[model samples]
Target: MKLLFLACLSPKTGNYTTAERIRSHIESAGHSCELRDVADFHSPSDLAHLVSQNPPFEGALAIHLFKAGRLLLDLRLPFGVIFGGTDINEDVKDEQKRVVMEQVLLKARFAVAFTEKLKEEAEFVLVSPDSKIYVQPQGIQTEVAEQFCWTEFLRSSEWHSKNLHNILIIIGPKVDPALTAEVEAVVKRATGVFLAQERSQQELHAAMKRCYAVVNSSVSEGMSAAILEAMDLRVPVLARNIPGNAAVVKHGVTGLLFSSPQEFVHQSQRLLSDQELRERVVRSGKLYVEEHHSVKQERETYQRLVDKLHKAQFLA
Candidate 1:
């Protein structure tokens, strides 16, 4: 089936990466998939024109509910909507977007949430008894180059001069002002903590390998690719103890979760001093990623969705 995969195709962003991975799986299954940037279309007519040219496209898969799925509303296509982090975390709180998202959810043949907690929250808001929300964690794979020099990376980062356990904070281009200030304060108040932002995926992976622990400071998330990548690379994680983060990082098990800046600072020290704790979490983290977020599992899930959608479209 020829399919349109609508998502924010910004390079290295979470939505783009997730859409790309799903698109790859669909294409690998011998289905033709067109990945279009949600940002590119201005209106339903713009999208309608694009789909018209393709002629007889089976369906579409939209990445974010309120953002990307909004445009697909009038397309009259049997589409599936995938929830991005901010959609369930922030947009559901906005009255206007929340109303539109509920309509989108109603129209969607099925919707996806990264965790069961996220699905529960979405279900509460949509209040649909027969909602087709599914929990599917992101598929992840990690590999550090054989010649990756941790010491050299530290020296270049100027983190080597400070005798501290370097912590990498993964951030994107446009961060919330409040979140930015909070992360900055954490870096300043803590002596050894360092910020590693604005790096390429490969660069970030190398940094993840060298850093003592990776930190996720986001107030909201669907499922953090960075956290998964860190776990895949056997790096211990310190993340905000929100439902999404908690869903992935089990406190003192897979990784450490902190409620406040004070807790984060305290845990940072613990992560540095407690060798046994660090080793156990790192080992458990690797195992968790291997078992939960495998490429094979992700591919199979998408394949099943594709088949399901095709069958639905054929019957319709």
Candidate 2:
């Protein structure tokens, strides 16, 4: 079968990771898969022209409901959608996008949400059949570089030894500007907290090893890859207590959860001062990722989803 996969393939985003991973599994299953960045197509007509090639695709898969799913609305082939953070968290608040997303859900043969909470939010928009909306956590695998010396990296960057115990707040390009501003304000009032922006995945992992604790300040998420990465690296996580963050980090067990800037500061200090707590959370977090978010498991699950789609095609 020939499949068209549409997503925002920005080099550094989670959606890019997801689309590429799914494409790999689909192609490995002996199907032809073509991946196109949604940025390349302006409308459903543009996408239709692309898919209308000689021997057109049998099916399509899109990453974000509002962004990529909207462009595939007019597709004649059976297609599925995977929800991005904004679709359920931010865009659903907008009346127009919510209405359009409802129509998209109705047209879709299946949809995926990273968490049960996300599935619940999507079900409210359109009462799709239970089997259509799947709650699958993102699969993750991580390996810290053998030569990664966090202290050396920090020294080379000229950070003070006094601040060596500082927290690392990773700021990605897609994070909400207002949330970023809010986190920045919190950072200003706190001591020994710094933002680590613009580093590649490997570099970020190395940096995370040296930090006292890593912070995830996103207002929303679709199973944050960063959180999983931190867990895999044995770094204790301190995240904003949003539903997305909460889903990944189990407060007082796997990691600490904070509701406000003040709570975040308190938790960071507590995590730093309490070595027992830190070690316990780090141990539990590593185990959780290994048990639940294995890359192998994720690959197999996606293969199953593709196989399901193909079987339905055959039945039709």
Candidate 3:
């Protein structure tokens, strides 16, 4: 199938937007796929003239739904939409944003929501009680993820290894200060990396392999790349207790969930102090992600949707 992938890609940093991954996955399946970073347009960049008019794409997959790119909702092409965090978490709460989001939802041949919670939220936003929304987890190539030796990372003076463990926190400029500061008290004493920017996919997987645990502190999210990647590497996750985080991490089995920073630190330290408990959570987390977030599974679902959409369009 010929496909045109559309989304804004953030380069010069380890920002792997979901749209890029879907494009890569589709291409690997022997389907022709081309990616255009629409956000880079109107500014001088190496990839200028990104796309003034939509290319002749048989299938157009829009990863983000925003006013800047809302034209896709009205385009003639049979499009697929992949929901990002902002579209649901923040935008849907606003009247104008909700309307645009709903418009995009209705235009899609099928909607791809990374989490079940998001699928539900999108349904409410669209008010199409019967919208065809697919709850597919973002796939991860665990085998190819970079593996690193993290002895030094564990040996820092603040890294209390005696009765503590390293728990990695992943986020970027998108994280709010209030939430970060609130969780700081819980994480300040923990031996972990509090990164303003996430590591590259390779570096991230490598780091996950070395760490005892991963933390999700997002006050709001759709489905987190950090939590899923940590699962791929078999790292235990201690995620914030929210719809987005809850949809991914199975409480008590995959990881502990908390609403506050104090709770995050408390649960984290508890998980660290118990080896057997940690192992159990990691084991469950690994199997859970591999089963649901596998690349092949998502491809099959997408193919089916595309095929169905083609038939419906022909019938009309």
Candidate 4:
């Protein structure tokens, strides 16, 4: 399959990570993928190219919000949207933001969200009830620590002196550091180190297994790749008590959640103290993540979605 994939191609964040990873997947399957960056882009931008030219693509994919995809509506191209968290969580709130998103979805042949909550939101908020919406968690390939030193993850922050106690917060653009500081302060009673704004998803996941727990302080997410990666690595998670995090945590089963800073601190202390409890959470979390969030399954589902859209558009 040949694909003219459209997304923000800049690095240093999750959007780029996702675009790069999936672009790799598509190429690995023997498809040709042309990636474009909207951030470094200009007006009458790729939008004009998509609208004016007859693309050699079977179907197109729009992977970012704002400028990358807003043009697809006018092009009337056969494309699918791989929605980012901001599109559903933040952009849907403002009237202007919502308008762009609505146009993107309405023009798309299908839309993919990484979680059930997000699928519901897409159905209710931006897309037609009949519009095809798919739920596929972002896939992760787990790496066990062998040659890599766990100390390297800790060395920079002097985390060993912090009692080998550290919390990892991997940030993208929408991540609120205010929430990060609050999470840090709450976990401080336990005397743990809180490291913010990690460089890569692989590094963050590796650290999740090394740390006692992983903390997700984001107020919103489309299904956090971090949360699933943490659960898969069996580190146990302490996350915000919100829809995106809640869909995975299982509340005291896999991990705990809290409404306020104090409550989060209370749960963190409880998990720290109870050895047997923490072990149970880790066991259940790992099992649950593998069963529900397999990358192999997700990619296959994605292939089927692409085939379906292609058939609907140009084949059938």
Q: Top TM-score: which candidate number?
A: 1
Question: The CA-based lDDT of model 2 is what?
Answer: 0.80
| Cα TM-score of candidate 3 | 0.79
Which runs in model 2 stand beyond 4 Å of their true positions? Answer: 147-160, 167-171, 174-197, 312-316
Better of 1 and 2 by lDDT: 1
- The C-alpha lDDT values of all candidates are 0.82, 0.80, 0.68, 0.70
lDDT tens string, model 2, 203-259? 667767766677787777878888888888899998899888898899988999998
For candidate 2, the per-residue lDDT at 191 reads 53
Model 1 agreement with the true structure over 159-278: per-residue lDDT tens digits: 535553553444465445786788788767654345545556666687778777888877888899989999999999999998889999999999999989899989999998999999
TM-score of every candidate: 0.88, 0.87, 0.79, 0.81
lDDT score for candidate 3 against the true structure: 0.68
* Sort by TM-score, top down from the best: 1, 2, 4, 3
Clashes found in each candidate (C-alpha, N, C closer than 3 A): 0, 0, 0, 0
Q: Can you tell me which runs of candidate 4 are displaced by over 4 Å?
A: 9-12, 42-44, 50-55, 64-67, 144-162, 166-197, 312-316
- Pairs with steric clashes in candidate 2: none
Per residue, candidate 3 scores C-alpha lDDT tens digits across 1-316 of 5666767666522224566666666776666777777564432232223333354456567676663236565455677777888787887778887887777777677777787778777777666546578888777665435455554444455555443454354544433488657666666655555534544567656666766777777687777777877877888898889888898888889889998878887898789689988988989988888888887887777767667655654554
lDDT at 217, model 4: 78
Highest lDDT scorer: 1
